[model samples]
Target: MSRKPSNIVYAAADKVPLGTLISLGVQHASLALLFVVYPLVAATEAGLSFEDTQILITSCVIFMGLATILECWPRFGSGLLLVQIPNTSHLPLAVQSLAAGGPALYAVMSLIAALSQLSLTFFTGALRKLFPPEVCGVAVTMLGVALAEPALRRMFGLADQGGAAMDLRYPMVSFAALVVIVVLAIFSRGPLRLFAVAIGTGVGWGLAHYVGLTHGPTGRALADLPLIDLPQLGWPGLAFSWAMLPAAILTGVISAVDMISTVVSMQRMDDADWHRADMNQAARAIRPNTVADMGAAVTGGFASASSSAAIGVAFATGTTAWRVGVVSGVIVVLAAFSPRLIAALSVIPDPVVGAILVYSSAFLVVAGMELILSRRLSDRRIFTVGLAVMAGLAVAILPELVDATPDWAHPILGSPLSVSTGVAIALNLLFRIGIRQEASVPVTTDDNPFEATTTFLEHQGDIWGARRDVISSAIPVVAEAAEMLLDTGVAEDGVVLRARFDENDLDVTLLYRGAPIEIPTLRPSPEDLLGDAAAVARFVGYMLSKRADRLLLGRLGERQTLTLRFEH
Candidate 1:
């Protein structure tokens, strides 16, 4: 039977109402715009004139908008409703480039990173093997953790922004905004639920204005802005540095990892019967971002990648319609030419931004947990997940480690997603050693052969990192075969069970000193089954034939063998 995506109001290709699309676009554009602060900080740190800063910010906004549209194109993007934005992970590298060589240098570095990501498209088919669900989970978990800390700090008025005085209203307004969003998303139906995030942010912004949170310099900044403006291209760096190459290339790799994980998450959201990662589709999805990022480089913008938070937040609306992404992308592009609109978004109170981020973070953290637990875990896998998670948190939770790291290492140290994913890949590879594809064990009638067979293969499946669905389907067939061998007295003394597993197939063989179970090509008659024990064995063979992909009756020297093969 065909499977339709559940909990979805509108799927990717659905036609959304014009009004709903416009509203959803505004909400998404606003969310994507929040990351503008990263580049704003970079421009501020670079000490550029107000004009130069606008140019830089405008370039980023333009490319981000373009990226959003391209990411929905099947040839270029994951063909899902993924919002693209200025990457927060690239902040350290952006700051470094802007300081050392200006926008031109940063543009060149970004181009290099984009090229690196483009090169990765060739190997997307192998990415799933390299980053299994558990590994992707580690990366995603850290991505969420990375988002939560700064957001909570700002929301609670704990972060020192220019040593400003702490405000009690920050928590009050932010928490209220959060509750509003949560309640609407969880309890409301139809359009109310669809616009939950947009409504919450609007309420939060209104409260911020009413409470005077934006009445200070923030208000002044927006008030002074013109209604509309044209963008100027930022400088091309006259200087160059080989020292930055490692970080730039690593940036590309990080972007690929982020893109792949986001694509996987989207695939799961789009398919109710999802059981495994589809690397081919993941490759197709990431191609457009790499292309968009290349455009970003020449335009003097930071490299762009998929926003996992945007995916999580929008999913709450139950409409991942590709049309929304297209409309949202167009809105972002149009907003780039409007100085006042950008200014208004830029001045959103820190606490409100925190509330929205906190809302998005819940989805990310939970998705990561689900991906990690999607497969069964053995002792080795448990340690791999545990240690990798702790490694990511160590970087995210501890201030001292980031401080102790030299400035050159700051880019890596600042990105928990990168650190955790790198650790997960390394540890996963290291743990793969010494695990044999083939295993053997003795079986007898004394114990519950069914339970023993179940326990044995389940353990092996975990360590082998086999597909959960394949492992699940194989279990009952093998267990039932084992029970039949002992119960039917085909093997009076006992049986020797041997199993072999690989990426493509699972083969289980029972060797015993007895007559072979018949490999029946057709169903036996009920009257034939009533005649003798042989007829019953034939009936058992017919049932096993239907259960397994393939069955063989043969001999292993002096003993008979029953072979069951499952396509993995």
Candidate 2:
């Protein structure tokens, strides 16, 4: 029943060892902690004092932990190893809200985002078709692509403020860290593989420490912080503004898209026979993540989004046990109470974090490509994927384009993952205008049976946007039956091959005024085949049965029908 890839050491449902669970949890929690900088930057923009800023950061961590735990439950969450972290996509908006009306307006935006996302749950089924595998694949790929600049910047020793020259030592440390991660993830096995991310990060941290690369304000006063204390609460009263609603809604939608892409990628990684996305599951996945946004609303925390990078780390480590996610969530909550611990994680050498992101990004990008190519690509689909990719890259590639967009457009046009996926979904819906889901061809005795059948199916397959392997597999079933109907001389005029398609099934039904083609359950032996024409025909039926997923022989009023079904 488990069709997960061979490389999967522990799947989402598998019970894990306590030690491995804790180890992996610590790894993911460490990665999640690095993202605190997003909120830290937002706080700086808000002009809050040091104490209030620390309070905001703690609130983000508290909810991040709670959301992670909630995410492990199928009723409330994605039931995958999708970690919730501060939404970098919303950072611009967060800054705007903070500047416009202080933390109160920011909290309102977070609440708006929560409601916007909550509304999407009802339409999960509809959203699936609108955002096909290619569109979702583009989103998934960009999730990794977006990580490149920050990863590289940190890897090259970019400063906290800006415009810092790349340090040679930074790359040296990053290179060492990346090698450790890659070697352990790709070449090692057992516990070594399971703990690859943590091990590599530890190695990187140690080297950075030795080389005096762990340079940050937090490290300077690490000894002064308490080992454990209650995280201070700085409640920013919520107040909604009409001006902020559109932007907040946009952030919610973008965050939802991010969740969908990450969940789809996780579904792909978990199953070997991933045909299409399970959107019901995807919707459920989004539920817990959106709820995390609601967590931000009450706690005065920054808005959270699904972390594809965190999942990348899981995939790289060859395990995605839910237990690890649960315990890691707990660890994050505990870490929030320890300022020294936060301080320790805060100063965890930028290059090392960069190295981890770089390693994980490579996995996500390639995995996304596999998802995009999972189905057959028509010219229409090719354009859809290609154009969407360019649009997303445009955000990262051209800063002026983003800067020129109006304030309302920031949530959509500002982020590569957001703009790219939005374009793909829109274009996908537009291109679906002329494509017919059904097609038929009338076979005449004068026409070559193979040529007519193939041309019709192939053409329709492209227009219908069918899966490549699926349509190819279906071609022969229709061809063989068409040839049989014509050669047997049982048709009144000729025969009509009709093909119908939906997301789950590709059905081809042949209509002819003749006896139904006999579907033999048993394979014909050589003696049986040589005996008579009937046996040879029966053998042909048997052969076709093997090719098609399902075969049906029946009559519809005046016509005897033979239908072949291919599971899409």
Candidate 3:
């Protein structure tokens, strides 16, 4: 049986009931709060005063809200439901910069990095060739793998790197939280499943309190926080330092890669017809992200990027509406000014935070694996991805190896993410030196049917031994069918047209999710063609039947496949 597509609301432009929107908004806000750990860890590591830490946190939250709004904006954003937050991958580098030259220098480094990302947006098309799926995928997977140690450290009460003994109770509490989260994620349904992280955190916090294991700020301390305090605004004291440049550049590149992957993931979750990312759209998405990072730096916050955790929440809740993201951003902005709320959140048990990190990090790892495995894994791809992952894991597991590197190269080689990304990109490019590139292009509604179809046919002609005349003739036929699909609104986003060339025939399959389309063989009468919308449909059907040698439509689950075969 072909299961019907779910009527779940999706996309930035899609509308949902007000009540549901509000609920989803709150869910997104809760999930986004997990990012607070980034700035908190940075501040603590930098040995900043309580007041200074509060300022940094405030700036981070406010700018994150502003960024999320920009990311959801129709003109500027990727026009997808994306939530922006501090980039965890940059945390170690951020700490290093902060330690090297105070908050001002750190801010300057972040600013430079943001500018670099902004510059890269201009060359996104070119960069895509270098940073293909395998490279990006390995880097992304390594990011998750790298995060596992920190998560474990927090879970086991060994977060203080200065040889703090593990607290026996920490693992018990974190494990309980992990179990709760895993159970809820696997067994719960709908909104409850989306709240697994929040719920699990609460459960862990309760257990820690009951067991007298809560170690951070007490509730009494939070109560002392003032109800309202205006945010201190000023340009981060800028200091030019050559030592920071390498880290800045590496951070910018990593941020761009993360943004691309995150945006693609969000789009896939929101749109059923999204087969592959629209690189142009991904480039557009990076512009506002760089702007946000610059904004954060100016306001005394660390570097920021899109939040995968929030995207995971959206996927879980089936809430991809831009309005929900807007509301969530508003909530964060409001929370920023509330000192008590900030203080309370700051006091969340470390074990609970660790549990949440574990939960979210799992998603990042899976997303990365999916991206790498999206194509057939030939030996070349396997080697490219395997080497990258192994290299990244080596760096992540062995801190001493990074320390052994020269000081100047530390910023680039110290982080597992940087190492993995570099290795994957280098290896992928090296392996492709003599190999012929495949003729494949991602399709979206914004693409021109005539151009895409003609390119596909021309490329396949050489491989299939089809005559130029036959291949040329099939272009219009394919283009018209694609036009028909788009014009009739049969696919929500667009279809992926994949061409397979065999010895006897060249087959082009259009993969999309929609109702089964009926192709008409007989030409429509003049009166019928001149009538209504059905007339247009009949015309498309008649055209397809006349031009195609064979047309086959099949449905598996919700996906509808249209295959056109032309005898070579």
Top candidate by lDDT: 2
Query: Model 1 misses residue 291 by how many Å?
Result: 1.3
Quantify all predictions' global Cα lDDT against the true fold: 0.79, 0.82, 0.72
- Stronger candidate by TM-score (1 vs 3): 1
Residue 37, candidate 3: alpha-carbon lDDT: 76
Cα deviation of 508 in candidate 3 (Å)? 8.0
| Candidate 1 TM-score over all chains jointly | 0.90
lDDT head-to-head 1 vs 3, winner: 1
Off by over 4 Å in 3: 1-13, 44-52, 161-168, 271-273, 437-568
lDDT, candidate 1, 1-568, per-residue tens = 2154767787777788999989988888888887887788888887766776776778788888888887875556656788887887677778888888888778887888888877888885467668888888787777777778877987987766557777888998899888888888888999889998888877888898788776423556667877787766755544567988777888888888888777777766767776667787777767777777777777666666677768766677887877788888899889988878887777778788889888777778887888888877878878888988888888877868988987767787667888888888888889989999888788888877777888888888888877677778887887777777787787878888888986567888988898877867778988866766677778878898998999988987999988889876
Candidate 3 per-residue lDDT, tens place, 106-171, comes to 888888888877887788667766666666577667666766777778788888746866777888
Candidate 2 displacement at residue 32 in angstroms: 0.8
Write the candidate numbers in order of decreasing lDDT: 2, 1, 3
Worst 10 residues of 1 by lDDT: 214-223
Question: How many clashes does each candidate structure show, in the order listed?
Answer: 6, 0, 0
Using TM-score, rank the candidates from best to worst.
Answer: 2, 1, 3
| Model 1, CA-based lDDT | 0.79
